[model samples]
Target: MPKSLIASAEWSLLLSRLRALAPEAFDSQGRVLNLVAREWGNPGHGKPYLSPVDGSQLGLLPMIDLSTATHAVASAAAEAEEWARVDLDTRKARVSACLDLLHENHELLALLLTWEIGKPVPQSRVSVERCISGVKWYVENIESMMEGREPLGLISNIASWNYPMSVLMHAALVQALAGNAVIAKSPTDGGLLSLTLAMAFARRCGLPMSLVSGSGGKLSEALVRDPHIACLSFVGGKVNGRDIAASLYDRKKRYMLEMEGVNAYGIWRFSDWNQLAKQLKKGFEYGKQRCTAYPRFVVERGLVPRFLEMYLPMLTSLKVGHPLLGETRAAEPPSVDFGPLINSGKVEELHAMMSEAEAKGAIPLYKGRLEPNLFLPNQDVSAYLGPCAFLHVPRNCRLYHNEPFGPVDSIVVVDTEEELVTEMNVSNGALVASLACDEPETARRIASELRAFKVGINTTRSRGDREESFGGIGQSWQGCFVGGAYLVQAVTEGPPGERLFGNFPDYTLLPEKR
Candidate 1:
């Protein structure tokens, strides 16, 4: 049985805070306010968000057409130009104060995340807190980052909703601190209300940051093709990133794209079973929806038994349920490990992939129980999937090549060092990979062959900490990278139009590391 750490009294107070969340994707001077709902004798002109928690309707957020988006971007560009003229000191103060505002409102934002996307309360709070704190570190250090650089005009960031505050708002805040006005499209799936409040608070603090909510199909072309956007920072799937990359290819606009890939963990000569056991649960946190999740594992044949010994028990120990509910009541103590995926569609997709892998050659290692009892009897449980794992998933299976983007795990068995690296790199390239080998020479040799941006020799890595650079290799990333000083330079330039990254013959970027 799972426990809910939230007391009944606290849950009621949290609900009260969530009810106070009004949608507002604000621009400076409220320029885009009139565009939210045109009121052409119709109130049903937008999409209504369905709560992943209970399949209930949250509220209708109006969708705008391409023309409205164009107007919004142009208005933002004008604001950016004006905002750029403000003294650097004032910009820093306002932006830092904006971080302060978000910190104060994190509880409300966390609740909105739980209600909107079904993220567990603990992880949601951590995302909000980590993002605000990390971005604040950048604000205090931006002057040095901008020492020899000049601000680019308008920065348009289109990001996914998984880590709305940490990734989306994090980039936007740093862009503002760099003297660029930031504009964003609120992710279609979730974070609409949380990011709306973030943008509104930014506007109140005199930062030129704005966000729009609508269908990506309707707004993506305009958001990418618009003339006023000086740079684009995107966080989403590879297909959408490719589309935006195509639009920017001939135009010479700067961008930083963080896309998804099947990050893998390679296990070779290793005997630290207890320590390795401790890391398994953390790797599966948030149902492995994270872009950096190591969902694929390549294990040496000798270590297969040892690996399952740790992984199987870790799977059983994981608890999944409604974010706010316990086994008995809302007030019952202890929280779940995670909640549902973004939607039922994700659950279906994961199940389909798992089936495909099984049909090819994979053997089921573990399949935990789903606790749909935590949900309302009348509510849908399609979004809930328990921890699942497969052994010896063949190279021909779809799960062997692509990221399931859910809690499902695929492990490939290999006999030799060469086969281990081959299985690890079978996905061609990725953002992160991990290696667990007791021998330092084997670890060093294996690490050199893996095609990933960040390699954890004996652990896992993620887009945490302000000092670390975050970007991917191969299809996982496009355009220049973002993080630390590289992030600020994604928009600014040492000299106007000076190139910051080298490109392959086809123009895919080779991110510069200093």
Candidate 2:
């Protein structure tokens, strides 16, 4: 059996001692410690941080007062010029050193991520690795991407709870590489540990912690409105992203919005069922919390019965249990394939959405069950919802267009290639669409017609290649792509002529008579 990912006795003791010495620095009860410039401040009112694993109250996450937040933004603004002036080699070295620091502390961060966000230890570790890889990717590609571009001054990175560390690290590293100072706002839920650790590592590399730490709705709005913040990178729900974009429109501030999508997948008649099933299972990863998860499946009419026979059983067999449990534990069940939602509220929302679909005449292929006995002793299973499959969903049902954002699957049947593409394009917007067609021409046709930033052939999951651009079209994204070469552009600005390599005819030179 493999060794446990949970912290050992010595590490646990050390963490406990640190917490005891600075109780306020950690969230306890209804109090939280806000970090700014290496100083921990308590702003009084805070929200509770509940453990998704057991629905237990972990502690409180403190909110930053608007005044203090403003001061922090000013500090970041002042620091931007100095940071921009630093040599490119020195900046790259600093970023590389920070990556090393993250690797050295991977275990602690992974454990904290699991406890705070309810992600399994293995998956949490993957997130940390992804963060490290993002920094390295930015450092390696920054020079070419920046070319003649100038820094956009201070950038405000507002991150979301799902995959918080990866998103924050990706935005911060790329922005900093482009010589922009950044102030990253932690998500209201499950961002305390990841953001705090990242701030500490960044400060050690000579960046100010205040430049990257602070949390509060009003404070976040202020940051968006602040003229000094030249760029804003946000990752969250579509509604909030729209609000941020609207706020920035008048300011003419450069911003990149990474919003959620109701990603879809098309299964054709010739598609391999076994291979397709494997790809479809990824939708259940993290219990469909991922924005890229394929919630809607468009199956060919003739293939629907065979697809259901192969898919429903797999979804039903998924283990829903504590994320931290080890597969090697004799007394415990195997490692879980599905964990609880972020909180009990999410569970309720998912059930409501599913019930609405059922009421709208959708046939339930597999109704999900909530087993209280599946969890550990004293743990609340109310937040745990098992995987569900639905078939013959009506086009008018809310589930047809809305992203359930839970372990729920809706299968829509289509007769022809045109019908399949039409159904895939029904979502208001989508980041990606997966095509499981064997014919190259069919795949190409569907990919071109689908209104999404990315179209995968025979692959259901989002790609991990750092060189690939990641973003959506229409309502899915309000700005430029978030990763790859586009990120440098997202955080910097320069004249149009600077982006042009060769001399071209000036538009003013067009025939004077015209």
Candidate 3:
């Protein structure tokens, strides 16, 4: 048998601490979490949880029976009702305490994220920090946001694995702060860390919720179909999102769908190529696994050569290695830019996509190669793939239209703003897009024409301020927008008058008395 990846003294110590908290989940042999059933009576039926960084077995996740799953949902609903009666201020205090707990255990969460999802420790730390910030923001603004709304009862939150910590938990925490109970289903690939975080929140906040683990097969289907669940919030692929939307529509339940799309990045001739290259590197920060990562690059015809010259080298220079072994820096790491893809199968799929694009007349600018240091002797290295770039990909190619949720980029040159806008909207609709131009007038014009929810000027990063409203247009999203004041409204229902203190006016002194 292969040696444990947590063999280093520091890693071993962290694992020991985590095991102490959840003894039934983490062990020296391997971490095992009973996701489905509480007891592992039949060990043979459990599924293996593989670490994307090393292709090693991290633990086994039990597949619970349907009756057990239903019980979990019912418990969550009952707890949510009880929680709804708690004073809003008391709930805010609990949420604040939970955020403090998360901050205190930041290191452990970062380490677990590095191993579970193949994100570098530095990047994982940033994600944890973002979660803390988001929670803090939601808690501070909760009273005002919830002032005009009533809790929507029970929220069935289904999150994706790409960003298990911040992206998933942000919504869950928001719903909780709005006085709604949550029944969260974490993705199977990254369930352990998410479960750990959720359990920590429950313990610290004394909140009512259920954090379950399983492939979104029968268990999730049951969750969405449950008549008791008031709303369904999902972040994942378009296909599964569509299925959930249809089910929710049939049941007459409110739902929020954040589906995947082929997001784009546009560069005008006047854009600063050097600084633009720096920002564009964010596109592949997590091997382009994020929904907001721009996979399509639409460049002006005059600037194509300059953009490629500056961008291809930056793409090639990115370090691909084990998530834990990479060097950490204060800001973004100069040497190591990203870690591995999710798994070996994903790596293979990305390579196949690149090959298909090349076969269809796409010019390979930098065909990435895995470094020798990325692998251990006798250890499977299939999960790791270096960054790849292609230029002048044909418009009809699938790579041009599809979301290549990996570290693969396609550059297309357009001669005019009209052509550029056409190319930008070619994906039908997207979550967001970034335009790099020097003129403010041009930026404003492009922003107005974009079909995206958010447009960045002279920036490639997808994330906006925590207080800003975010979502997509057309097929990219459904229901309503998310984040800021919008998020608090989505998880709850009814107008201000229906809420507990909605009918009351602000306290004031009479002008005559003064």
Candidate 4:
């Protein structure tokens, strides 16, 4: 395929050019994956089909060559380390240059993102803009974070598939600009997006190939164990993340991981019913698949009956079919609210969990059928699933405790704010929580008591924003933030450069005399 190009000397001009290009769903030679849209939404014929608006999948996305990714990581790292040795201004300039390139090619990058996954065109555009914003944010703040630190000289970047281009781009580009060599891994599901990003950086930013690498199975283990691999950063599920953390601990590696969340929302004690209804609808519209998505509702006991009475009609109105066919309003089709689970395994897992919940005596007020969803044709396609809302017996049930990680949500009634806080805190994970309070005192109280990393007082908390410092606390994550200013500091720089004078032969003697 012919290489796509981005040429610019000014950041503004470059960004403008990028904004002007049409969406490039395929490569110049028409070799990249193709997408098919139906009346329901965009369908997939790719290796990893993720919706750009939401990270939900349309089909399996392709994986990049692990060797190729590794090579790129290694090369980028070397380039970054060399850049770091240069004067700070020069390093920043180089970093700025890469950012300029990224801005200049935003359209290509966004389209590459869309095709690699299944992001809507508009959302894909936002991802690119967000990445640019992230780079600038880091550029403005990274220097102070690196001062007075012992030269650790290593950065480990483990990225996920959800926002493949944006996540890895931040880690790789900023670290390189800050003068640290990066050893990186791309998620197994979103390989093409990562590879396209790798190519873009190499072609436009002049990144070396060695700085980025990927491995599957034991290869990931080996990469993690590589002694030169320094600061490790990971994004994935809780189980695999913990296992990876254990391995890092065994190797005594300095690392961070973004994992899972049993995220929750506290329906306001006295919320405006109409506005609350709208917000809750928007929450479920997010497909309830994000790590930070509102997965459970803790309605004040005084309000549960009324809230249920008021909310079910709205819930029943959701159209849970495909996301692309402009199904903006209304519920999904008769059977499914959204598309199928990313894979059959996920479907089975969700069913197993639901069955376990049922066996535990949690009566499902609303049951969603996986078999029907899978078998039902949506927008005339073979693979869409509708959304389902279920009400359970108790909030303390295992289903409520564990993350559904899908569009499914449940309700739990708490009598007091204290109980709500206690329940949210007691959970082993802590990604985010949404408190839907209207009064200032109530919002403040909930915000103060909430134990999650990201708190949403009046809105659904989101994990995908680049400007936000996103990552979970507790089991949800093992690190600090992932984007905005924090990501730059996390990789390229550390605390203020520390100065220590060691004993020197003749020089030490003269200094003592002075």
Candidate 5:
């Protein structure tokens, strides 16, 4: 058989299995996309999910309209106090059973997640596994977090497309574990099927975790302003975050807003370029779509050559193609380094950002080309851009301030010590920042100077696990946090404070409940 034919066969087989993960998305005869899932299921609206690699319609999802979404929120709010009254031990047991269901269907969910989001296979699998593990950690350790707290009605989690399961949905599950009724808005671009399946599993296990899906503009007002919604969690770009924050300003609501920032890594008087290079290579695992992705690099004037020499090759060598394609296919296919953006429109946006930066002074280190796709060879590879990186991005450039949420960003070379910190902190607030300094005293100094949520010295950090807290400082974050106890507190009612979690720098100083 030809390679394309083989790939087609594999694609069909895998897609069938993926569809099995969420039977709600299909009809008995496989015609309707009836996908509104709550206590009772109904068909709302059909939206076709386009493939990121080729712009092909992967499947049509039955999404909820505004009325459906409002009802879901109202229902969750009305039932939350009763849910809180349930014995904590019983709640844990129910959630544990749901996690077991998630575990059993892990491979199924992971397969669909990559197809929906354009993440590589290995990376998507790890995301699903880690989501399960992280939620388990919260469930086991949440008793201490509820000390002086009460369940804060309904927590509406609305986040970006990239980390629907691992971050946004992870926080939603933890909210339920913290005794709040949870409702999550599925990312309209991707992850609809996987999230709906996970929520369906939770609902089946007796958890009041409802899910709604639609465009943000249509539902943002309803979800944010709904009287029943006690807290709102918005995670996406800065514009959306700001709009939601503004809406909740006068309202007595618990909220967490995590927006984008220039997550920069500074190189100042560092010797180990090779080690730094490897870490940088691994850092762009998911096309830099992650909230914690270090898309900007601030290198010392003297170290620019060494940094580029070590970093450029890794950036340019990234492979972009269909997630199902590989040299050999077996139990687990050989993973590609880079995959599709959410869709073709995003690819065009990335091009525009690169063009703007280039016109302003940035140099294109690489212009990525798409590889031949065996999986969907006939379809145009519009969403797949191989590996594109830029250097000499001016401080005033839009690319410097706005994060290009794809596999592209720029490097800025700075001369003076003050200039290094100045350029790194130019975004004012960022999710994460790191400085590469082998020397201890200088590393500590540089790390302290960073105005980011998480700072790393000679290493890279991320939205960490159970013990570590995750929140942005300054403009990057605006509300309470997620991760361990902080996440629990954010969803539950409590007194105002400068510190909620352990002394984590990126902790969002939540506003007082009026």
Candidate 6:
């Protein structure tokens, strides 16, 4: 089939699938356009632009062939306006229904996620579950949050590829439940999933089709610059997020950014050495691809010998295979402990970093590699670079100062929490850091002393939790945070608009209830 034809066909298939899965949206003339795929490249030569988890062609529709992304932004902006105008009770009902609709179509959605994003099937399931859970939380708490019912006006949700559906949907629904107009954008990598969910919303709730647009290129730029999109929520790398922040800086946009973190796990103290060993083994389960994955580990001088005594063996025993085979934490065989970096360039960059680290005297515990000419025409496989080595380096080395985003984790020894804090602050990124101490006092001290935006105590960290605000300080973000009532604040609680009715509610009220 011709590439353009295949692109059109993919859109058709997506619409049909969504219609069947969500009859309500279909009945309401709601259709999702998978815009970003069509914007990125041409497709249908059998060799996909993207690679699947099993080394097969990813077989996705290209982004360029789709309709102009500008149309998507306009449509979504329109929907946001209409959604904002709707009564809070009605909006709540629609959001609540969406949660149910999501649950009812979980399996279908999961499959689509795997095909569209190249995540392993098991991880897809978790994403689906997390999305649903996030929806449930919003539904249950939205009313309590909207005490005044003054709309925040505009909220924008920017999502990433790794867990597109869950993160985007969860954040969007929370904003919607709070009665704000939400302008959302899916990354180039997972636009399919984002657009599909938008179709579901339009069909099920009789929502304006414009509410969720999925265009790429200039369209996304337009959406970001739209004066109406007052509050911004973003999830992606620090550089791009920072750019977004710079754009919105003068406008004073309410923003929430879950930017990239070169996260670390401190093995200074552990409640149970054996348990820590087991957990860290599973730590690389997601191929160490997640922003919250532990890419660096700090071991106390005294604990190093004993910790490694148990930790090394546990890591070695991990099953590096297909993601479908229950290895949710790391890439596995057939799958490896991880998939390739998002693209070849990332692979090269990772290799360069490893090489540089090795040259700098960092010792590799498990060296990672990718074959030179693996993308042959009939290989029936995509790219597979197994997890790289876990390197040990001096506390102040360059390797220790960087956040190895992939399956590479570096080890540094510290004699005190003070030293660990100093070393971690060594890098400019302060997104997140972890503590795995056996003693409560050490964990407490580190938690108090640490300069990171978020800290994980005795466990690998993640960004999905709804109550906790997930953004970093310093170089990690542009002052936007997501979680709790922040979503509501971002959209509805901005600076006063045109002076309409009476004076703003009284600030100096009477005595307290207590």
* Candidate 5 TM-score to native: 0.91
lDDT of 3 by residue, 257-310 (tens): 888787888888565777887787766788888888988888899887788788
Lowest lDDT sum, 10 consecutive residues, model 1, at 35-44
**Per-residue lDDT of candidate 5, residues 179-242 (tens digit):** 8888787788988777877887887788878777677888876688888888888888898888
- lDDT by residue (110-129, candidate 1, tens digit) is 77777777888778888899
lDDT of 3: 0.72
What lDDT score is found at residue 149 in candidate 4? 36
lDDT per residue as tens, model 6, 1-514: 1223223223336446666654532223242334221121122112133444444433333333223444555555555666677887887788777777777777667756655554555667688898888778777787776776566655666677677667776776777677665555546554454445544553446433323333433454655666556566777776676677677666755565666656666777664787677667667755666776777777788888887788667666644433333322222224334444454445567777778778778898876444423222344333344665555665555456666666666777789767787756665556667788768776877776665666777765566476765555556655535566655555565345622211111211111110
Model 4 per-residue lDDT tens digits across residues 100-146: 77777676666555434434435556767876777677677766655
Alpha-carbon TM-score of each model against the true structure: 0.91, 0.90, 0.88, 0.72, 0.91, 0.78
- Residue by residue across 166-283, what tens digits does model 2's lDDT show? 7776678767878888787767777575666666677668653353334545786557887778877778887887777777666766777777778888888564888877776756
- The residue pairs that clash in candidate 1, if any, are 3-334
Worst lDDT 10-window in candidate 6: 502-511
CA lDDT of each prediction against the hidden true structure: 0.76, 0.72, 0.72, 0.55, 0.76, 0.58
Candidate 5: where are CA atoms >4 Å away?
Answer: 1-37, 327-334, 373-376, 495-514
Ten-residue segment with the worst summed lDDT in candidate 5? 505-514
Show where candidate 2 strays beyond 4 Å. 1-32, 37-39, 209-216, 327-332, 370-373, 461-465, 497-514
Q: Which pairs clash (backbone N, Cα, C closer than 3 Å) in model 2?
A: none
TM-score of 3: 0.88
- Please give the distance, in angstroms, between residue 78's alpha carbon in candidate 3 and its true position after superposition: 1.5
